[model samples]
Target chain A: MENFEPVIVAFCCHYCAYTAADMAGTQRLTYPSNVKIIRVPCSCKVDALHLVKAFEKGADGVYVAGCLKGDCHFNNGNDRAASRVAYVKKYLEELGIESERLAMFRMSAGMGFQFAQTAKDMTEKIRELGPSPINVAKAQLKGEAA
Target chain B: MITAERKPLEEIIACVAPFRKVLLVGCNECVTVCAAGGRKEVGLLASGLHMALLQQGKSVEIREHTLERQCDPEYVEELNSLIDGADAVLSMACGCGVQTIAGRYKDKPVFPAVNTKFMGASERQGVWAERCQGCGNCLLGQTGGICPIARCAKRLMNGPCGGSTKGSCEIDPDTDCAWQLIWDRLKALGLTENYVEMIPAKDWRTSIGNGPRKIIREDLAE
Candidate 1:
């Protein structure tokens, strides 16, 4: 029995991921609605603070969707996003949070099907991993016993 | 820029033991620029400390605070109320800021969260290279902006040491030979004449020697 319906945050870059999502909607590609999308100008603009804050806010998983490498509307934005993602993953492991809680994906604007697949895959992965510890801790604080 | 790196979370956690109420101090200057002891690092360090303590079944009140510049007394004073309830303070600044905390709060135990490396600059993102020895001398004009004292494996003043091989330092092949870097930089800038100038032995007297160093600018003081 699936117990946890994971709340996942998908940070979609306005340049690509957001456009890709629009395409997915137009294409009527079915993806899990568990993922909530936040639009940012560039993936490089996403900082470590944003990733940690999402988890603190009870996101079971966080994913950053940026343009394909070298195709960032803002030059090098995807590269910078890649670095931030890697750094935050290490940081999450260090913070006693499973680093897999954070993930990054690269796709062109035309890859609406791929975007849907990514969302579906990430939601399933989080389901397998179970609720994030931060969320569990919050629930306990709210007088709920695990 | 001063060279610095984050202390392993294990080491930092070990230092904070036996204290329940603790203040985590992050510096906004060198440590921040180095990504070792900045505000963001303060959060990361605080979270790690909290997780470590929780895992051990120990309750710790880890308070996070960052100063504009920990080395300055004014910034240290800003932490007065934030540290009032804490049993101990963990400083994520360089050695200078650590001493400042100790000097300011004589009653509390102040610990360091980063190893003060050397005076250096960021070679690239996530890469810091030691550039200055704090020898109380500036010799950038002579070295073509490549600091031999810090870059050279041997700190050779004149030229590349015999240990240099194929433009790489013998100590580590991945590291560019310091003299080679200097020569390339000078050639690029058409300043090879600067390399001909002899650099004298670093004088120990002018640096952190003869006791704790102090810089008092009477004009600026007013």
Candidate 2:
């Protein structure tokens, strides 16, 4: 597992987290490239299906970044997204995948440092958890085939 | 409508463990309203099963479908072409929907993914409570639109049954006493006279006490 490089999918809300990520870019803040940002109109738009599909499609970790509390442009989209993340986390546990691999973070439109820091923290967490079980199984299957 | 909840992941995994290809069927009827077996649930369960099976080193091909109404023969017929490719069928509908698919395709192994809870009404968003028991004879008119058979724990016709305390049933404080609700409704409508009108003993034959029941209409019959 020494060479393991985790692939993290970060679902960023368009009005807040996405803009924060842009701020991180302009500020020259460097976060792990392991995290790939998928901009969504609102975190509420990120369905449970999308979270599970990320793991299904080989994401080692996934996290949703939305507006700060009460700052959602749609008024409670972040709250909805937070609950959805909690729900999907429970499902992940039921699937035998570690729930820590999924998370929800809140940030305002100007928190560029917060965005970069979150990406770094999540990457570290997933790195510590190693590759997700699905990836390990796929690798095992591939190894057997080879 | 009939309400249901999905069976545990362990139970579902065990049922489809031997199959390589599974047809995960969902219904758009009661189960959907109950948030149990709808298109959204089908996607969640399918993805869950995939990861769970994959973790055990078993990759499964799960084809997901949500029928317009699984209990109807016409809606179940839509799976006719897709059935050939699947080794087994996993229905996320109530028992009626499961049986519909099972009855239509005698050759395929059909399994239920949800436990049919009861015929109930949604109390609110994400909350459902049993409201009816399908007792052949309904006494709602006499009880001021409340059913004693289904709501009362003891099914008492004339009751507040010393078990009722502060408008809640003795069995659970959270459960509202059916008789108490009936009295309140009757009093509000100024029909308190119905409360003392001695209800006769109910005939058990009208219920499922005798056997399975069915209704036939001559005009509707071909």
Candidate 3:
């Protein structure tokens, strides 16, 4: 019901998006606390399995935040992550999960506002989508009304 | 190496939709090298199915197992202890592996997760091209080692068929005319005389025309 709070997982690249998240903290920008950030070596390190596993572990939404195109610290890490995120999005749709639950974004360490904006946007979108189907199933399995 | 491609995800998911528990078997031989049914792929698929089935509230127990070679009985025997634990087996091997597993356990159902593609060689990384037809005939010596049966758009014996232009096949611009390759090969070997000689009609008895074919060597029989 209206009390539902969506869970979101964000895989942020250490060189860019992760640093941006730290910047947002220093700037005192407020974003949904439910969006948990996992700092990865590079956006490319965020594999398709990790995204799906997040849902399996009860996350309602997942996002991969990498450096802007051609700005990857490792010279194409963000490019690779962008495509991998696309692949996972299609894979999730086929698996019966809403494609809106998974996403990818590009940002720089200087874009603290953008990082906060992405967090707020993802939280809003996932809240509208309600809790993930996996979470609903898990709740039902425990004989509780979701 | 034998090549295969993973079957569409929906089809594979549907095949085990009836089962509450399933065993996922991957082969380490050809499928692994081809990036189709390898151990890593098995893990990817198993986790995916687990997540999907969980969302449906279907408590499906999916287990993962990888064999050195699914086509070999010795390796397949490894599944003997685990087979009974699952309702069905989903094989991520080629057709031969699927059949081998099915034959080993006649009582259990075996489903294929990949479609066997061909007897081919890797053209490059992640790219495969057919190079052998296994016509029960070895004619590579005559065609400058390029297989006409497999490479030719039309399995022509004495050809170019006049449809070839600039050494490319008429069927597709990317396809090289097999006869052009044969000519280039024969010329390089100074065997132009052999090119003009008739190859004669192939004996159909040695091929699939004689039903299934096999090599029965009594000397090597166990």
Candidate 4:
């Protein structure tokens, strides 16, 4: 487990988090490479299906990075995304998975440092949790097949 | 519309635990409107079930489908092809929908994913309140369009009872007293006379008190 490198998927809102990620790159801020960012028009555009699908597809950790509260390019998208994240967290708990595997983060377009920090923090958290159970199961199945 | 809520995940997981393949059916009618069973919910449940089962060291195949109306025989026929592949069926609809699927496919074991609550109207976004009991009769005319049989805690024929206080039912402060609402509506429409007129004791034959009832419209019958 100590050598495990977790896979984290970040759904970044195009108007803010995605731009912030670009800014981090330009500023030479170093974040973990484990975090893969999927740009969405708005955080609200990230549906529950997408979040669950992430885990189903072997993502060890998932997060939605949107604009700060009340700062959504489309008003309340971030808030909506937060509630959806909360909903899926309870669902993950029901599935016998750690709810902490999923999260919702808020930041503005100017927060390049925040973006980099969020990625680093999320990566560290998932690394401690180790690989997702779904991924572990898939590995076992593969081993059996081989 | 009919309202329902999903059963606990533990119960559902247990039901499908023995099966390797499951056919998850969702209704696009009442269950969809109540947000209990629909395309989106089917996807969420399917994914959740898949991961949950995998965690148990068992892999299950869950095929998802939503019908226009599960209670209709023609719509349920849509699952004919998929039904053959699944070992069991998980229905995410009201009880009627579950029974419809169970009746259509006798060989496959059918299980309900949700508990049918009641005939209701959406009070607001995400909140629904019971509105009718399907008494097989409509009494909205004399009750000022409010149903005492369904809304009144006692199902009193003439009520407000001693339990009415501050426009709310004594049973629960949050619940509005049906009689109070009836009085207010009657007063507003200048039909207060209807309130004082003695309403005869209701006949229970038309309701569930007797037995299951069915209606056949002769004109529409084939």
Candidate 5:
């Protein structure tokens, strides 16, 4: 018997998290293969709709990774994204989902260990939480598509 | 612009709980500007509602559409094709937009997802305050451009009521008396003499005293 695996989506900003992800590869770090990364120009570009849509598409967990506070490549982009992330978390709770499923993480481009650790931790957390509520419908839809 | 705030998620969920399918409509006008309802919001809401129902062991089909402006019949006409299979409509526009859709689709139940707040201006980012009451009259000419009808707590026409103290409204210490604002503007414009002329009693007929109001222009009619 095999253990349950989780699908986690990570929105990484170009200036920081995305670069860290590359650095992690260079350093030969290994993280869960289920962590799908989407590169965005800046963390602020990740809209609330995008977060919700990720879940709707059957992502068991989602995270926004950007530069550390006050360190955004585009001044205050990370700060603005932080506020949006907090607001989305509250909204997710109201939607009757676990707020912990969505989170905003801050790191620098040189922090390859942090990037690998984030992917590992998010995968473990989601594995424990099991599949998202919409996972069943998503699976059915996939079956129909097949 | 008409301002609105989204209703609590529970209330919106309750409205569509009975239906197996719903069409969530968003407006691209005032409600969008206020960050209450827009295209992005429509998608977010559709996802939220879907997940909420999914958690309850229910499978519901939700559709999302945002019109150019929901208050206009031309823009609303776009929904006719999409509304055929939906059980109910959850509108994210102002009260006028909700009524427009309800009036158009008489058979389908149209529910409002936001509370129509007021015809007002945003004081700052994400903050709105009442500015106009739409009393069907233009008294700004005489009151130094400050509207007493909307700003005044009692809607006093002549001067400050006895309740006013220290240039603030009696209702709340934080609120500035509308008449005081009128006086200050009048003083700055050297039009303080306008106060001496006693204004006559207002004609309530122009307001909501009668019923729902309508404006028809024969020349502009198609």
Candidate 6:
């Protein structure tokens, strides 16, 4: 049987994390290509619904990388995003999905190393957790013979 | 600025136990602003119900619909098509909206997903504070805009009970002394003379006690 490659959705802030991700590319940092990046104007723009939609769309792991504390492009944007991420984490737990699947990180636009570390750490953690339990049940419900 | 919170998931599930095809209806008015029932809450409740039904091995066709204001007839009229497809409606609107939905759709069973608590405002974020008893009498002109009917531990119209100490109520230390607040505000506005005005016991007949109060605009009704 082929190994399940976990799908990861990384919401990268347009101003900082996205640029840092680009910098990681330019610096030739090697990380798993399974991480799909979505750019938003600010991390605060990512609401609880967006996180739920990501999970519904089959993301095994999700992360919101924003500016460091007090460095939000929009004042307190990262703070708002952090609170929402925490709130969504609780909802995920209530939904029987592991809260670790959702993560919030802070990084400067210059921290390509930190970005790479986050990617490696999250991939390895999700790998250890195995395929999401909800996904397993969902595949069975549809009778696709996974 | 009415404050509201969602009813527990188990309670909501129990209310819709008989329905197979359930439409989880949500209101985007007071409930929405308070984060109890809105488009976002509709999604949460719908997912919750789906999971619950799935666990019971009972398949429920779940759908979600939110109206701009469920209490108003115009927005509820927009629900005709969605309501037609569902076996029952689980309304997240307040008490008034629930009754309105039932009245509007005589044939369908409408269930309330939220227990309407009170006519109150937010004291702080996610904290709802009751401010009005709907006494039908304007007492704020005398009490410095604070309603003792709702705020006081004992609904003393004349003055504070003996439990008040250091400008806080003894019933709960966290609460501010209602009469103290009234006195301070009255003093600030140079309106202490209003406190001396001996107001009689409130006439509650004009309020909800007499049942189903109605206001008809005679000139505009035609």
What digit string (tens of lDDT, one per residue) describes model 4 on residues B171-190? 99999999999999999999
lDDT score of residue B137 within candidate 3? 81
Model 6 TM-score, all chains together: 0.89
Task: Determine which window of 10 residues in candidate 2 chain B has minimal summed lDDT.
Answer: B213-222
lDDT of 6 by residue, A1-146 (tens): 04988888999998789889888888999778878899999999997888877876678899999999999989999988999999888777765679999999999899887888888888888888876655665665767444
Best by lDDT: 2
The model with the greater TM-score, 1 or 4, is 4
Candidate 2, residues B102-169, lDDT tens digits: the string is 99999999999999999999898778999999989989999999999899999999998999999999
Clashes of 1: 0
Which candidate number would show the highest DockQ if scored against the true structure? 2
Which sections of candidate 2 miss by over 4 Å?
none
> With candidate 1 superimposed using the best TM-score fit, by how many Å does residue B19's alpha carbon deviate from the native?
3.2
Docking class of 3: medium
True contacts kept of 2: 0.93
In angstroms, the error of model 6 at A49 is: 1.0
For DockQ, candidate 3 versus 5, the one ahead is 5
Q: What fnat does each of the candidate structures reach?
A: 0.17, 0.93, 0.57, 0.93, 0.83, 0.07
Give me the displacement of residue B4 in model 6, in angstroms. 1.8
* Model 5 reproduced share of reference interface contacts: 0.83
TM-score of every candidate relative to the true structure: 0.85, 0.96, 0.86, 0.95, 0.87, 0.89
All candidates in order of lDDT, best leading: 2, 4, 5, 3, 1, 6
Residues A1-146, candidate 2, lDDT per residue (tens digit)?
89988999999999999999999999999999999999999999999999999999999999999999999999999999999999899999998999999999999989999999999999999999999999998889899889
lDDT of 3 at B53: 76
| Cα displacement (Å) at residue A64, model 1 | 0.4
Error of 2 at B184 (Å): 1.7
